[model samples]
Target: MSAHTTASGSTWAPSSRKPPLRARLLRASWRGLPAKRHDIGWEPGLVVPAADGSPLVTDHYFPRAEGDFPTLLVRSPYGRGLPWSPMYGVLFAEQGFHVVLQSCRGTGGSGGTFHLWRNESSDAQATVAWLREQPWFDGKLGTVGPSYLGYVQWALAREAPPELKAMAVQVGLHDPYALFYEDGALRLDNSLAVGAGMTYQHQGTGPFLRAMLRLRRRVRTAVGTRPLRDGYAPALGGGIPWLDEVLAHPDARDAYWQGADPGEAAARRTVPTSLVTGWHDALVDQAFVQYARLRAAGCETALLVGPWDHTSALQQGWPEVFTESLAWLRAHLCADPSGLRPTDVRIHVGGGQGTWRDLDAWPGQPAVTSWFPASGGYLTRQPPTDSAPLASFRYDPADPTPSVGGPLLSGAAGSRDNTALEAREDVLTFTGPPLSEPVEVVGPVSAHLRVHADTGYADVFTRLCDVDPQGRSVNVCDGLGRLRPQDGRTARLTVPMSATAHRFAAGHRIRWQISGGAHPRYAPHPGTDAARVDATEFTPVRLTLHADSALLLPQGAEDGQEVTAAP
Candidate 1:
């Protein structure tokens, strides 16, 4: 080990030993990852001052072999230990790239308070300036990481230097408001999960685990509180002021959210970018939005969507994620196009025994199919002859409808059996008969509902489910919309249920579920003209669905006849 001091007066000791056993084991575990090309060298706890003179803690890793290599910058708020070090620092270094893994302000012993997105852009630029002065920098740069780490990349990309080459964002988040609010309703559970993660994740593994456990155990009581704002602090071990701020603002148009989204960076920059996300990841829609903006800006971009959730994208899907990211970095940053794929978009189709599909672009021209809900709980190609209501359900805030498996931030996310959830009286299910042939839904999914609510203030939760032959209803995609009081008449609402690339197998039946709300997943509608977070009174709401309501799906040809709109 040899110690060297930087201009910032922070010393880092570089080791010339072989890669740690953990890093080697992790590499071996990911069979698809490229073979290691060099021994590893690393320096820990190097201080890089932020633009405002706040010290930012950083760690550097490089290949011991004699060769100039491109540098990959990874900034994270999730601590600089296990998983990150082995995953990014050691592994990428062994692959012949210098990796700089830094801790965000206020976390990992770095100075300055962590105000979420407040200081990221300036800190990122500061790190790059420090990189320019390093003796090992080779002028080529790439950025990679998941979630908040990905956010930092977008922050820097807005004003990136000429040396910045490629970026790979996996299951990343660009808009914090979108992550916490969907259409006007607060995402209670996701907000709480994010609160706990940001508050304790950087402390250490044990503390983070304990905090999560504490959150899990107390979530019920917390969500059940009279005033919704008071419920989460106990579960999180303390009050997270940022989370409180998020809860306070339910409208995305609020000025509080200004400058919070770095999505504009994608539209402005022409950087070659690669995005990875899962169909069930909580930020899957945000990833799609990023890709769309990048492509619209004429930037060279690629997309990889798997069949996993946010965390699973880094766990079970690590091999594929790592492989895709490595290929993108090598192709753009190292000028190695040999490893690049022929297509720009790759998606994992979900159903029985999932399969991968490559396409020139995402969701290339799928036929729009409409299915109408008829009386007797049937979803059919024919329009309803009756003008009467199709179904009705009552939602009680005190006993709000429970959320099932979906794009949640917790461990209980992704596709799970929705058998019990569909059985609730508050939930209405419209099922189509068994498919004569497999129906492939490959693009955006949405619901056009004409509903009448007894209370002006209510919510509509719509979900798409795949019902197997064995009578298992599994969630594929879902969306929630907050309803406001209108004159005592029917209201037409369009609920965007995100997107999916799922195959409803031959034996599977398609089901559309509608309910007043998916409690906890969304903060329950108080059924009164009052803000959900501040509402003290809980009121029950009766919502009736009209026969004219329809489920719109982007589908590919399956059988000879197409499922067209009813005349």
Candidate 2:
């Protein structure tokens, strides 16, 4: 485990078969140099028996020519054809690595029951053992995938498989609590969408499911209804019961979450990992938390953050992201880091700093700057001395503020034009004057608000926005905090907004939009101590924000002098 065998030492078997037509063309293009791309062929339905005696199905892809090669494995439930294998499995095989794309238990062509994370660890261990028995496997192996695919890598790494040399994980959500729920509020839209997709895939894409998916408006309407647990019964056809199980457990404290969470297995990890994520991705925050935990356990890790959402991280113009992954694999699996970008932290800064920055470490201890709310809808660096500077808004559960883009999987995800959202009377906005010079805020942001609600319970949502000279307000980061019954006393809510590295230009202003809820992204609070999403009782609650409330921003150096872009 101390060191991997060199690339030359590992490939002991010399290839005697002729290269495929595509490999020949690539060789011709390289003019006798090592070809980087080649044609690949796969053997379908390789039955690998799991520890439970269930057969796990996989498609193994390799270069057309016969030879010993390092293996790259991917275990996913999204099927093994088209997008999953054709896009990644074939790509790696063409690069001289044998790729194994397996469908999870009870999914695609695999066997056994399908319950998330229950069978992955054992199945993965058995599969790795099976690969070593194959004649074509060289001694090196690695894993790669994104989202759930990424989660599988982490799950298997927890088992500490000896052949598991390295991993390339992108947007992986190992914590089920955070994945399904946030701040004790259910992520309505995301939970429903994932369940619908799984049901469609698992139960066969029948006419009913296909028709329901096409009519998205009906889906949104159903999500808005009370008794959220049973709302999806019609669309899902009574299948994929996991959604209700998640809603039943309000937070991470429950034991149900332990099965899916990486748990103590993370400390056992010896595999070097490369993590890729986007600033706007729903799981970006969790991705960073996982990296920190792995690094604390003395594992080698690197991070790459882009300006993409969950979908764009894989589908959009993000080739450089995967290129970084390839380099990481080559370094650890093949012991060759040539032509590879150095292993370091890379981040994409938004808000007019349209470039990437490489750092020796994460932006060190951001200079915390505190900005307070002033009268007449304004934000100021100076605290309000006025004894009773207070603002009030009426929040009716029937008319909750709608979601407008930020860390969501729905179509309306990522930053969007928030001009209309900011204009709502129910949403309190405190704006600062145009900055005299540009300022960079590059770390976690939090807001401290002393709030009082007429009702026993309420939900507080805070957003950070950049107001351009043309009056367009775009969301940067936002978070939600639920307040319990104060019993006639004011409650102090410290809402920790998402982290970001954005710059406000000289002519732009900073704004904070405070509301009671962000529906669909988060279920609307029912104005009671019971945080259940099924309650439909609408109570109009008057909420007050004390002038002492302030936004804490982690600012960079004075002026933008210290902020530099990587070449």
What is candidate 1's lDDT per residue for 1-567, written digit by digit as tens?
666443345555556555456666766666556778887876778899988898899988887755478999999888888678888998788787999999999988889888879888888998999999887788899999999989999998988888999999989989999999887888888888889889998898899999999998999999999898888888999887778788888888889999999878645778899999999999999998998899889999999989889999998888788878998999998888887777788888789877777778876778989999987888999976765787898999999999988998888899989999888899999999999999999889999998989876789999999999999999999998766665454788899999998999998899999998887888888988778898899989889999989999999622222212110
Clashing pairs in 1: none
Off by over 4 Å in 2: 1-35, 201-212, 386-389, 486-489, 557-567
TM-score of every prediction relative to native: 0.94, 0.89
Q: State the weakest 10-residue window (summed lDDT) of model 2.
A: 26-35
C-alpha lDDT of residue 282 in model 2: 88
State candidate 2's TM-score: 0.89
lDDT of 2 by residue, 405-443 (tens): 999765677889899987888899999999999878887
Where does candidate 1 stray beyond 4 Å?
Answer: 1-30, 486-489, 557-567
Top TM-score: which candidate number? Answer: 1
